[model samples]
Target chain A: MTARTGVAGFLGRVTAMIVKEYIQLTRDRVTFATMIMIPLLQLVLFGYAINTTPRHLPTAVFSHENSDVSRAILAALRNTAFFSFVREAQSVEEAEHLVRAGEVLFFVEIPAGFERSLRRGDRPQILVAADATDPVGTGNALAALSGVVASALVRERFVGAIAEEAQGREATSQDAFEIVQHRRYNPAGTSQLNIVPGLLGTILTMTMLIFTALSVTREIERGTMESLLAMPIHPVEIMLGKIVPYVMVGILQAVLILGAGIILFAVPVEGSVAVLSAATLLFITANLSIGYTFSTLAQNQLQAVQMSFMFFLPSILLSGFMFPFSGMPQWAQWIGEGLPLTHYLRMVRGILLKGSGLSDLVRDGAALFGLMLLAMGIAVARFRQTLD
Target chain B: MSERAAAPAGTGERSAADVAIAVEGLSKRFGANLVVDDLTMTVRRGQIYGFLGPNGSGKTTTIRMLCGLLTPDAGRGTCLGMDILTQGREIRAHVGYMTQRFSLYQDLSVKENLEFVARLYGVPKPEAAAQAALERLGLKGRGRQLAGELSGGWKQRLALGACILPGPDLLLLDEPTAGVDPQARREFWAQIHALAAEGLTVLVSTHYMDEAERCHEIAYIAYGRLLAQGTVANVIAASGLHTYTVDVKGEGPREASQRITDLSQKLSAALGVDMVAPFGTSLHISGRDAAALEAAIAPFRGEPHLVWRKDEPTLEDVFIDLMRGKDARR
Candidate 1:
């Protein structure tokens, strides 16, 4: 046989390496099933389980006046569905204590002469203070307060005006009341908009990390790496060969998640598919490279899997997939900036929810590219060419 | 096969074009353990070189160094006319190494494994090459079977087939027939000999003396040191040991084994009796000084139940003696 040379030989060797990995992956039934099942299972589980617009928040109300106006206002507050009046506070201090003790998420206070002042057209105010530690839980509820209170007072005045006309007395205007919404935290609230795209990054990071993380170490543990090293393949070629198959798997997972998000949860994609695909491909490669790095660094398959999880924990927690990205402290945001998932989360959310284009996602895309390069570099450098 | 003349041992003066592997002072250390001591050996092209050693004696390490699977901690060498240190990749491309353990992708089918090797070597028409290898291995019908499911002998056969699928210049087989049955081992040696006859060099390691006798050249290393390097006859002749076989007549297999053990212990303590080992119903007593050995065994020759006959020392006798000699020093 003549010596193998030139581009054809390289391609042949790389293709063989890739084809071998594909065959092994297909043969491992449990692993193959897991690759497809994880994304679908997570999408179904997290998609419906997470809700930002929370309801039935426990609340306590303290009213000094035992009048019809205070009763009607309290009833109206209950109708908003955001507050369930679980406790009736006897004093203002007790109401605040209930909110602080976490038994109630909201507290309401009405002054003693509020009804009389409103009847005299003096514009007396009613106070509503809310526990706002979780901004998303209280944002929309507080925004809906002013509208509900004014309409309830208007209805009350209309009924009173009809009675006064029959009794020969004049009814004053119903615009004599003011509602002070003292609730703090995010006023805009959150929507399903952030969740679906976050799921895409999260699910991709999890499965993609484990997939390539086990590739090299599994070969080592099985004793096949000795023969592999004896072959005519470069380390970079082997890394790419191992990663290429999982990149395809990653794409499949991304498609499964995004497709499910759009179809099942009505999560919109406001950006171009091309940009999303490009960004998704970069993010997937970045994750696969990290997994491959772990594979090369670990001594055995178990250690490889452990290393992958070690990296996965930080990627999931700090990437803002679980928490609000901007709401985190400075140190966490700095850490988040270094993770591929963090940038991918931003890119995906920007594309799907914010209608971000290529220019709008340049920084995030560049971060993803840089992360991919860094991981690939480390993996190739750590890859052992000889058994020694 | 006709007997061929033996090459002079350790000279390694063969020209560059004819020598496939010629290394000098190849040493390796694994942390505190010196796995392969300063060792020098050569393999002429188209000749089968056999390695003999006990477990952990550095046979595998030497083979790895030769094939570029390991770098010597302190040494320089050349394989296939390329520098072993700098040209590892080039040497690796030309060497087919079968490890002591079964190292193929077990989940892959036999044919897929072969095709993977073939493609990696850039063999034209990998499918045809793999098919031909399967046929040659007599595994054509089992081409689709998972490699892990194959029996030991068949796995060894398929491993050899995969190694040769790439048509490497030198095949470094580390104890290729370790657990194989005698019949399969004979067939494997036949294949190795056939490959050698076709001008392909083979370096194989094994424990069986019969297998070592079949090689054109052999090296015996114990404790990371080369104790013997020559042909079978040359190594035995160089040892200068005088041997005698004593058969102890007995009532049954158990009693005969007992008598042989008793005689071996008695003779082991006697003066000039360097080695006394039991093989089946006979005891082989050998010593380096021939006259002392003869006198030492003369008293036993006249015993009623024992019959003695002079014999040439076998390779196992020579190796055990070498191991004992080394053990005595440590």
Candidate 2:
């Protein structure tokens, strides 16, 4: 006993601990496969299925005058990437029905006086109405319409100026044109690029946390924990033994997700891979620790899984994973920023596409580190006390 | 520390230096109810010590504390010469405990479970140890069988093998033969006695009187209190119950029984007759006072329909008397 108190002895014990854990892990085939395969599944599903930058938006037009000017506006709208002219309406009533039924997201109506006003050098009014139910769809429609309107106004003023110069009239009147632009992040915004990277965070968090939460509680239900506890092993050793295998799974998930993002959506890893990997590992650890904490509190495997879903629900909704962060109310924005997922998502996107460095990711990194320490500390403390 | 000669009780078979376990003032309480009260007892090495008690009499709790699986709330004791409090791990290491219910891995094979336990206890050469245990327990052919698929008797055998594979100095069995068939119970006791003969101290708790009679010494506890402690012969002698069997012939056994009950009450007032129980076509009446018991059944002696003869009080009579005495206290 005296001779075995040094480094050699400690290493021997650790090796025995690791070998025993691996043997037990291999015996449970379902859990082993889940650990290795779930990440790859998540990567492919989220990378290809989710796209935030909207394209080919369905639009309808209503023209009362049936003139060349009205026809020209419809043609210009179709020229942009934002709108795909789906139908034409003879009256406003027909266009309104299309919008309400969700047949078209945007509709343009030209009044009866439109051609007459343009010919008399007076401003002709045109109405652009878009469905506001889906905020993303409405935003894209408005962006494309604004570009079309500005060009039309510029051409009209140019024509009037040219006519005045040819008539040699006193240049008392002025031609006015203004183009107001509203740009959301990556404003020529490709939905695939924005959503694919964010999906990586959401998918990884849900799968990894849920799987870890069920692991311990399942053993407890099966009565295997009694045998485990009877062994002359420390609780901390068991915790580490359980987590090490899952950490490898987390890394594998990250690689699969990154690869899918590149191959399917051209999501570039513009930042340092090391920085991204480090941040990702921290966030995954935080999530796993949270799951372990739930496991300690739950009485059975089903309850533990349910509790994991409960945590995941608020995280996905309030973390700005699906919606634009700035568009939300101030309180919601504050809440979104406070969530651990929010910081991790921002960090992931910044690193993968924005080429963010360690210095650039300080805030997100600090938040994730704090969350990891807090969650792991609470989980270990709860688990140790739970056994007693 | 003074050397004393062995007491001449059961021939020179018992020795004074054979005290394997000694404990004093053992008490444990759960919340408001006391599960085991202050108690003192001793067990000799190479002996099967029977612990008999009714259900909820703290037999299991006492056994657990003795084996170092549980800590007594207030007590001082030594098990296998290790301090119960400070050297619990060491005590547990040297004591094999089998619970009433079968607690084993159902998914694992019998051999795998034994090997796992051996490794957990840090046994040297676990494979060899498990193999030897299996062969010794007559489970050599069924070592690879799933534990869940085994019958009750087979499961019991496997449990016994797992417990003894660690080579503990003492074995604590809590109702080890419960739910086992008559033949299996006999076989289990044979194994227990064999282990006891090899200087392995055995403390077993059971409700069967036959099992209690096989032990070198028996202790009966009721409601957290020790009711009796001694060999079967000594306990029966101390009970002081005298008995008489009355045989009734013809189709009037029931009528004769009623007539005897009336006679028993009359004699109880004058001579203190204790209990009169009907056994099929016969009646057995017993009392602690021998003179009173003989005088009480005198009236039924001269009839052909009822024949009364003096008989020895069985162990069952002694136990029934003890249970009645304990019940009267509550």
Candidate 3:
């Protein structure tokens, strides 16, 4: 009987504890709402917004002759559900520039006299240069290239032997033409080349954001902010004091990650080191400003951390860190454009893999600058000077 | 109004420079609840003002308003001759506010916390200032220790040391000795008196009655209103309560205690008896009218084994009467 009563007593104490916790949980309305909303948001975002096998990738064509066979090949490539012919370059130089600038993923070039040579069965070659920096984005689209072009020529009756054979003539060899494939930037299509630079952006965003997000809220929770605010100092001075130290830490963190990326993963910096440093500095400051803004908005340390995670989830998911940028629907891409990591990822990859200069990445750099100013503005405007 | 009107002569009329804090008609509200309502008082230079009230009775709110930590929703005030609303930053520069809770950074050492405050207020030679403060507060040996690692008494001392590091002319302390030991509290008061002798005005809030008696002047507040404000003697005299002490004898010690409890209950329900309280082995009964009190106690005074003597009412009795009277009016 004593043992049974002891067990019942334990159960009774546990019941009281559970009831107390439930009441506390409900009293904190922000935490309660976040608990229910985060999971639902994740479900909706992952299910509808993400796509792995991306389609309608931008492509450019530079055909030497306006022949029936070239038109047929272009139409055939469009019908394959993998390519979107967004631009038709007037010259090979223009097509190469389009691919290099990342405006188009693939450039198709047909040499002069290719149609006459094919008619005489000389077996001429056409060139298809693919921007292979993100292999996942261009892999399947490049794979369907030769088959679609060959079938389209036969189907269009542009192949001389195939057309003649339709009138009961003897058939000849069916080798219509040749295709020359050139993979630019990363010729070997190594995944490490793509992932390492992306990891640099992802790591910086997570750490810089969380560091500053907890800075002010921790002071507030510990009651130190009360004494600090009671002093004769401006709010902007306090904000700058909190942010400047973390910027130094952020710089050290960037160096550590980039050093590890190069020494361990063999990822080469193909562009000017000055340009990379400038962009990294800008990106770090932008993330820190955004995190400080969250700190001002949150009521306490726990809420500040939750707000950081809420921001980080979208950054990692929609910033093309895990998936191809072109794979998501249009609206999701627009949302990605507003995130700093999305633009940073482009600049880092453009600098590291493709050796893009500052002029080529100016637009992305400006976007990061604009985001930093906006977050800083909100943080300053939301700062409270009194205990009202 | 009665307390102010009955203030001891020669202290009320002062020039602007003689006043450390002077405010009229101050009020503050949070959401739907009014925390401080139409309160007004003045503190002269070099005076140790004691702020007394129950918990959540706006003691801290009043102190915060004085130091410009909080803006009064409706009123005008001045701290050290600077306007509370228009010149908050200037007022804060001359005032040091030690919050009720320990507000120094726990992760920092004692010296570091002091130096941080010194630098914040732009004190020259911050390192030397922090060292001198440590020596003065008797915390020279604990300079390297974290503030959070100290006991309650030591933390309170360190908080005070940090507040005075900047050498402000005025100090506002909100219950600095709430959880401290008796010995520490006495020492803390001695330090306050020493500072007052040096011409620094201090406004400290506390719940201890003995501490209230130590103040040069005191203010009693309840329900967001200042019920009384004056010298301690003046407040007690203005209460106008006639008190008597009664000692009841019974068969044994337990019986005597029981007799006193029963007598207290009976006297509480009698006419003209406004307050009945037990202190030690004696019972105290107080009333507003002396004649009515004498008639009500005539029957109890003649009872067997009961001795009654007229006595002066204590500060405790007067404060209890003030609190009860406020409640009855509400």
Candidate 4:
């Protein structure tokens, strides 16, 4: 029954608006896709993929000892499942090179006299070197090595002496084997040490993309771009003029964030400030160019914002911000390698945590710069000087 | 021979110095519809030329082509003594285009908007030029206010001020005063005429008959085709419309005005009375031929309640006739 007045009419009007909104929402495929797909995609990708205690870390064993005890230790380390021995290093120098090149996460060196030390009960040291540039990547692996050592001597060959010493209140043979861990890069395994550097790239990426993506679209939305195109300005000049100011905004945000990170988190800038500044400039410009490209492609402000977030989603998840870069699958990592943020995060972490100089960041930094040039080229090409 | 070389605006013939904007065989098509079709037109120096057309009749597209803001799909022209196709950038430097909408940044202050435009045009002493534009346009003491906060009339004047700040030789104003009050429109036209008197060629597009009448020369276009172009008297004469003014009397002032409206409605459906519009205390009836119009109104001629005499057709009659004629063609 309908009393087609007052409250009923109001309800009818509200329902009318609701029906209109649903119709409009369904018409825009991009918005509809974003509404349905983004949440489900992020949930499935991040839910099963993010593992805090990352295992199967590529490890290398360096050994001069061929004793039964050394073999037992290597077998114990392999049985832990956290470390996978991919190669046998010829020497310590070779092992260090493997870690430096990011080929392996942990290097284990079983020193000489491992069998003699076990027989004499003289605690022989086992050195486990780690690549601590990503503290999250190596912390759990380093802490779990003690369990490897305890189970390393569980065989009947050394149990009688270990049992006799245990009865006499002397040190067991397991105690006689010592494991020394050297956390390289970020030795203390601090989260801030890892996060503060990544924050620089992430913050710049979010702000630069949004600020520039809205600028050109804003001019068009307000009907100012037609007059702008009618003037004697080139497309390159228009892109640059719209972009350079936002570049300054990105820099200002960078300076504030970096200063706060230094003061509040005590995350040390181990490398030269000048080198960090250069990489930051290149990274900020790259993101701004990408945002400008989106502005040229988007017809309206809503589409511009949607485009920005679609790019932002991949950047936040796959750029090694929330998860360890090496922990992700090969396909995910391949996609990460293509994003500017991935390269920028590496370059920033290299400079701040790893004490990387300009020469040290040449590979990732150059990739970031090349991305900026490509984005700038696309933006200039897509930016039409006339409405036609 | 190519339409380029054969048309009057062709470089092979007249020089670009005399014409502020000249385009020959201009045509533009969007998908299947011809928004502008093989239209040729020219405007001389220091003249205020009016473009009158219905909406979607390609007035803005033609204006943009002349100013080099748009490239015609098929055409050749020159603006400011430079080829509109190849030398668009050079032409843009010399032409000031005021858009149909209020396009200047509304968030910016009035003076700031003027200054930004001045800078874009590379005007020397930009600050002084902006200040002078503000004072000249009667925007003094309001430089700090946001442009969006200004009334429609003030916004119109500020837009004009911004256009003239660059000192361009040719100005293309697309409906400068569409919604402005009559007083403000009068002032705006007066200022535009003053600017034209100083050797600045002006091309304005409008729908108002009074505004069209203010132009030195008026061009009427309908449905992407040029219908008529001439002085107001010439256009009216060229329409071949014989008109009659029928005044009503023997009634009170209000009653007489109402009677005039009734009479206009009565004669509106007559065979030869093509247009019947109320004017003050009388009705103006117009048709294509004198004999047909007289024969149509002869039944009302002997009525004691009405008096009639021959009159000239109005500018509005000619334009509406031209519009209706185009509509009837298809």
Candidate 5:
């Protein structure tokens, strides 16, 4: 053939492949919708849902003194948009229970003589308790407490008293009702400390799910699975072999992201490196196995991608990476719990932020380990082992 | 290993033989549709068995059954002297199935594809084996070239290389030369014959007649049923088709060609004519009923420009006749 014919022939074959791919993509309605609709959904949904300066955080009050001054103080706290008192705790113990159960973000305590002291010019303290497990959630709320308190005293009687007793108190910290605020587990509310650890789960979940899902389905779509099935290799062997490479990829991605997190974000790793590594490995395997299960279920690479994105949608949106897990409604929390990311997020945050060890994270570790088994079991069971 | 020694574990009740594959009453049904129905066939060791069929005729389904890639819903078979039902993995170990499409990793280099397959089959000294395969398949200097970058013919060669890299006893090729050029197809057959000479049994499916003729034995199937089997001459002779070559030379060459084209259409639908196929410049009119076909074409025989002569039926003619007869019965 002439060079002209060769060039034309090359173009002809190239165009045919391109055209075939376009036609396949357009013909598959689910895949087409997933390609177009998912990113848009993620953008709009995550844009509104992820709030770092989370307002209307559930706060409860326990005041031994029920007077106008204390009421004004609580009302001012509400007005600051930092706290919304949804419950009235009868005692400080009840408020602590609310915080531990994740029912409230902040708990307030007013001594019985608080209102009387404000009137009589005797300074009495009021205590504020904040749930700081997810330190990012309550950081801003805690910072707004003093402002909420100082403005509350600006009401009619306290203002006149402060002006009258200028010599006694130019409002030296002694005269004001001292708002003792407790910044929870992560007192400094380090953003990197929060995000870097979460990256271990988020990055693994994203890459692991998409990689293994696409890899297996791609073999089927490329016609290689038929040859693979005809070979002597067992289905279990294929599954594990397909998994190990992506697991390595996942590990590499984790290391890179974690490195970036530590350097750029200054995220701290407080817990044992070995614990974090083991949990992360388990989490990566879980995501990959789930992806492999999806690969077995899906007919083509596009369908596999769609399945991964479907899993990713809930994971990114509700897995407590982008939003506080406890802040979401009970149903969303339940859904998040069912996802492996939820448990991994808790473990990473616990281990890296709270300095939690293996014993401290046994529940989340077990949940993650259990999820890996279930996903892997389903993947092996669903493997057809034949073209049929 | 001898036949008995080569026999796979768990099947001591049956005697071993030269047959690489043997099946009885094989049937497979996909949901409500039966794909392969009560198919009984045997392929002798160390021979090229040509499998021919129209599309959707269960050619692939049958090949799958032979290699242990599929299990027939109702059948008993042994591949390489191992029970296919109980020893699918054992059967798969000794069989190489080349799919209709190029199935090796396109991203991998030629050498890598060979090495991967070699490793998967646990071939001894994989690097040496892959190198030998590369050299044997004329892929010596192009070992580093990506398999995807090769032309259709080269891709086919590479796929064929992967199939034989493991030293499989039986190679099941599904339309291995479907889109390859004539020269490439010829070379592919040469390699296949060479392998068969070394006692590697092959069951290959194809659409081309010349390739079918190259096979030592052939089987024709259509719509999940086997219609004919045996050597090339045996299949054609058993077809019972009487073919007549019609040559027309009218006033001008163009006019004669046009006349032949027009006659082809009419003769295709003529009463008692099974098929009227254009064979190059001539037309082959064939039917199962010799007397009826001769009487049907007798009127045209008297035309001075036309010469009618009896001809041996081609494999194409036999397959065409088999397909038509099968369709008519349905």
Candidate 6:
């Protein structure tokens, strides 16, 4: 009878606590709005703003000769949806100027002897120059230009047997003229296949950190923390209790984002699903720990939110989420390496696109683990023992 | 230890084993200012101990140190037979401390607040404990109502209910009835006395003289010093104040008050008077010496505008005398 009573008593206490927490949660309108509104807002914003399969790239062409051959190539470029012909540049210098100024993403220049070479049974070379500042933009432009050139070669084969016969004397149809191209990642080149994996890091960082930062600070402002502190529960238990619910929320968001990436953008999960999920969970846990640490240092809910934004600003800018890590300066790369988000971004991208195994991601995993432990330890130690 | 363990109800007569809380040479200082200085007192088990002092007199600080919420800078004490410093958490587990301000969750229901407190203290069967606490505090049907929606009186009741839900052996109430209506304060005191009757030790700080009178023993602290400690009758007797009431008729009370003030100053030389303050249409004149008090009011006896009579000094008169003595020392 005593044992039964003890169990009943413990259960009663837990139930009462959960009910009280529910009452406070329902009353806190800001947390309620953040939990329901933020996810929906992120979904809509990310759905439209993020496009992995970049297409219909704007390109300009400069032709020194306005002959029928150059005109046919320009028409082929215009007919292809991949290359939207921006305008015709009068000279090679003008097209180069446009590429330098970033007005046109890529430019095609046909040399002066283009029509004479085709009639004389000699292959003509087409020079493709692109502004390689943004690797993604450069890669998409190169792919579109390659497609247009391949179709133009096939059209030349049917125009006249003399064009093919004169080209056969110097080389076979396969080696008539080569389209020399340069892309940033996968320079041997594939476009949408390279960037889809990197989007996971950006999505996780934005959602998980914002949620955890506000939850604890809101409890402090509403004066519910006093009741929580007065309980027999330890500080570590309280910290875990607050973080566990948010971890579940973060996982749900990850699943939805990954599902959408696969269905809409054709992003393939080339690596082990279990490994990817584990890495994602680790990254989310680390981000949430940072949020909890921010909560402990902040005096109010507004300050907590401001500190979260301070963390998020650096994560987006210096984590190499949108920009290439290798392209940045050495000092900038060092700064990026210091951020846990940068390591996570690399890990996710490496796993999804490169099919990297555990040995390849040992550094990123260890960095994230170290950061998570440090942040959670500080949060637990610094959380105020008294309500005051 | 046996004396300390005896419940307050059983110890009707004073005995060696009557102390509930005992401390000697208790002192606490904040920087240069002494917040609690050289205080010594003993409270019997089950006594309703009232702490009376003006603002900034360290009443709250003293209560906090007594309940183990704060450590005294210079003091050795025992609460419920345990050392105050070493056994603080153990003492805290058995003590219920209510701050002057409303510290309960405002957004939660009264029932929810009590349940949370019960869970905090690890009370057995918290819902049952909470229900019993609510019913005891006369808040039976208002369980579903939000604490924020309650009136000041109801909030006070809920706060009291939360504090007592754990069935603590000692209760420390710091101005628990402040801002409460008069009737609510009366009802609250009745509940406090009932708890004391059940062998619960209560230490309450209040500014009200009537509340001080309700306590089994009252301690008057002024400027961080324990000026007096005793029952109402004993404190008044120890104050050495001989008071006289002068009832003025057929004139405005303000004019009568002014006339009495004028007469009081004239007789001050012969009487060695402490204070002469007007209370409504009557003037209450007090002094330390009995012979001098009789002689000082002799002129007022012959006045046709007033009727004079000797009366016992009230708790307020003793408190005012204590305040004046403190100021005079300063």
Best by DockQ: 1
- Each model's Cα RMSD: 6.3, 8.2, 14.7, 14.9, 11.8, 6.9
Error of 2 at A125 (Å): 14
The superposed Cα distance between candidate 3 and the true structure at residue A155, in angstroms, equals 26
**Among all candidates shown, the one with the greatest TM-score:** 1
Alpha-carbon DockQ of candidate 3: 0.20
Each model's lDDT: 0.85, 0.72, 0.80, 0.77, 0.77, 0.74
DockQ ranking from best to worst?
1, 6, 5, 3, 4, 2
Cα error, residue B22 of model 6, in Å, equals 3.7
Candidate 1 residue-wise lDDT at A150: 58
Per-candidate count of clashing residue pairs (backbone under 3 Å): 0, 4, 0, 0, 0, 1
Q: Enumerate the candidates' DockQ scores in order.
A: 0.65, 0.12, 0.20, 0.17, 0.22, 0.27
Model 6 residue B7 lDDT? 29
Which segments of model 3 are wrong by more than 4 Å? A1-182, A326-328, B1-13, B248-251
TM-score of chain A for each candidate?
0.79, 0.77, 0.57, 0.58, 0.60, 0.70
Question: 1 or 4, which is superior by DockQ?
Answer: 1
Candidate 2's C-alpha lDDT?
Answer: 0.72
Q: Which has the higher DockQ value, candidate number 2 or candidate number 6?
A: 6
RMSD of candidate 2 to true structure, Å: 8.2
> Residue A17, candidate 4: how far off, in angstroms?
41
How well is each residue in A154-266 modelled by candidate 6, as lDDT tens digits?
Answer: 58553477654543443343332232222333433443344445556665676677767776787777655643543344566566656766666678777876776677656
lDDT of 3 by residue, A1-388 (tens): 0111243433432332233223333445774464344333433343335433367889998988998778888898888777888999999889999999999999888888877876776667778899999876777567557656665777887775843443222123232211121125653445556767777787778777876898778878889888987877666666666666556666766676676657755789999999999999999999989999999999998998899999999899999988778778999899999999999999999999889999999999999999999999999899877788
Worst 10 residues of 2 chain A by lDDT: A170-179
lDDT of 5 by residue, A271-342 (tens): 998998898888988998999999999988899989999999899889988776767999999999889999
**Residues B1-330, candidate 1, lDDT per residue (tens digit)?**
324336845673778888888888999999999999999888889888889999999999999888788989988888889999898888888888999999998999999999999998899899999999999989999999999999999999999999998888889999999999999999999999899889898999999998988998889999999999888889899999999998877558888887888888889999999998888999889999999998898777787778889999999999999999999998
Which has the better DockQ: candidate 3, or candidate 6?
A: 6
